[model samples]
Target: MSEISNNDDIRTILLPSAPFGIPEVTANDAEGTWGLRRLGVPHPDVYAMADIVSCTVRELECEGTAGPAVGEARGMELLGEVLKNPGKVARANKYKGGAYCGGVYLEVTLRDPTADKLIIPVWGRELKRGSMAYRQVIESAETVKAAFDEMIEGGSRG
Candidate 1:
């Protein structure tokens, strides 16, 4: 086997980034194209990309009403439905106290015609409603939207 060194297949692009917008700007605030932000004051709640990541749902087998084909559905899609409509929650025992107990997550499924199913996990800050986990009342789905935006704009990189 010989060397496969090629630079043509690689490229770079520059995007505008700033600490913060005028109105939102504080003495030490910032924001990146990827939804990264450093805010001035603490508002009720604002969503932003918590941690950017993605994966795929591989084929599997099982049994149930939705009966048994792992690859048939995308994990990301399931995550979305879970978040869109909060239900069936499990506590995070390992983590600290009551607050972190019943946390929620969103899985966004993404894929191309010939590409494998891409599953993206979106995490959010939720408010505890009795025993249920709900997004912070003041929180918007901005984080979910931002993450998806990154996937769309970043493409393979996302």
Candidate 2:
């Protein structure tokens, strides 16, 4: 196979904005150029390429969090139910030493033109895990819905 390029053919899965950009992810594959912008702190203890099914999602392993991955799964499950077309979610692989790390990632096959209608919402919170004015909030379908609702209702404040 040819090496992934920085072009549209590369599958750049767009995932929920990472909290505080602690665990930033980038990709250059058949889907296009994808990136996960983290919005918080608490740098990950470990970072690696995760093979979920046949696609790859960035695995962010942080210390002090235990359920981002699970929360993301539940949220995606809820979102899929709401959308009526189960969408795949990227999660941190605990089996690969990511137990303490909460994760967020993009699906490799989210490149179909029609799939553009599936919009992944974004949000923010007080930074947690440090002495700052931010906090780490769980990334779930509900959070995305709430965040999108807030954005549609009246944009963001922080």
Candidate 3:
């Protein structure tokens, strides 16, 4: 076989001293999973948002930083709690709220080892990895920390 063809080139980009780049690349993160994974992402884009979520979680600590929620909630219920009355929105299937000015039609399925996954539906920030919008999303320490604290903590049955 011919030498394995290598075409991928490694390049580094430097920002032009602007206040973070913008949503130059856009994709619908319907579940916010892709955005959340950046919390643990290993990309070295330098501009990559690996710690976007985790960093905010740490910064948003209260006097007594709590753990994840030790309970379960459906998508609608979680949305209602955040929205303070889903009104007619709760009964809907698809949430396209994020489309309104960088908002995300956020849906999250949380899991506990001893419990099932909790589906949370909320209208929150839309995070695009390496985008300034994502940078702003993580700036709110309270929101991130609260999300972390509300996570359900489960114990192994072993």
Candidate 4:
């Protein structure tokens, strides 16, 4: 894992690159979130892991301190949730957003154990619309799911 320190002193953890050309996974200590994307890709589609606790708190109109420990706890909770249904949980919790800078076409699919898979439609003015983009999305999702599986099995967070 590689670490990057921002001006705010938040350390961004770039997890090991996914196998088979999938984008790398990034974990943020401040926001308690993770995402899959190619570095330096401008306005790329957002393929992010969701933290239900944080989402729920936001939805119910709440806030909290942006501390490292808080983020660590949230990350642990997210891991636990993913452990429930590694395959389906990651797909369900994955957040997809458009490539546009200002106007994002976001699509979030809820968790459904019976569903085969969640399809995230890419949208953005600058998005490269082709087989490559489509394949990247699919591969990134699968990589994330696999990462969750490995993390749960190994009892580690990455």
Model 2 vs truth, CA RMSD: 18.5
> What ranking emerges by lDDT with the best candidate at the front?
4, 2, 1, 3
Global Cα lDDT for candidate 4: 0.35
Per-residue lDDT tens digits for candidate 2, residues 69-102, read 4334565675664466322222233323433323
Ranked candidates, highest TM-score first: 4, 1, 3, 2
For model 3, how does the per-residue alpha-carbon lDDT over 79-119 read when each residue is reduced to its tens digit? Answer: 66547744423322112322223232222233323533321
TM-score of each: 0.22, 0.19, 0.19, 0.24
Off by over 4 Å in 2: 1-19, 22-98, 106-108, 111-136, 139-142, 145-158
Q: Is candidate 2 or 4 superior in TM-score? A: 4
Give the per-residue Cα lDDT of candidate 1 at 55: 25
- Which scores higher on TM-score, 3 or 4? 4
Predicted candidate 4 versus true structure: per-residue lDDT over 14-119, tens digit per residue = 3333233223444444554445455455433332343211111001101221223222346778677667756544333331222212111212332344533322
Write one digit per residue (lDDT tens) for candidate 1, span 1-158.
00112234211111112331211211111232222222343441222222224422221111221333222346896566557643321222212233332223333333333544322222223334343323331132244334344544555443
User: TM-score for model 4?
Assistant: 0.24
What is the C-alpha RMSD, rounded to one decimal, of candidate 1?
Answer: 18.7
Looking at model 2, residue 117 earns an lDDT score of 30
Pairs that collide, model 1: 19-29, 19-30, 19-31, 76-107, 79-107
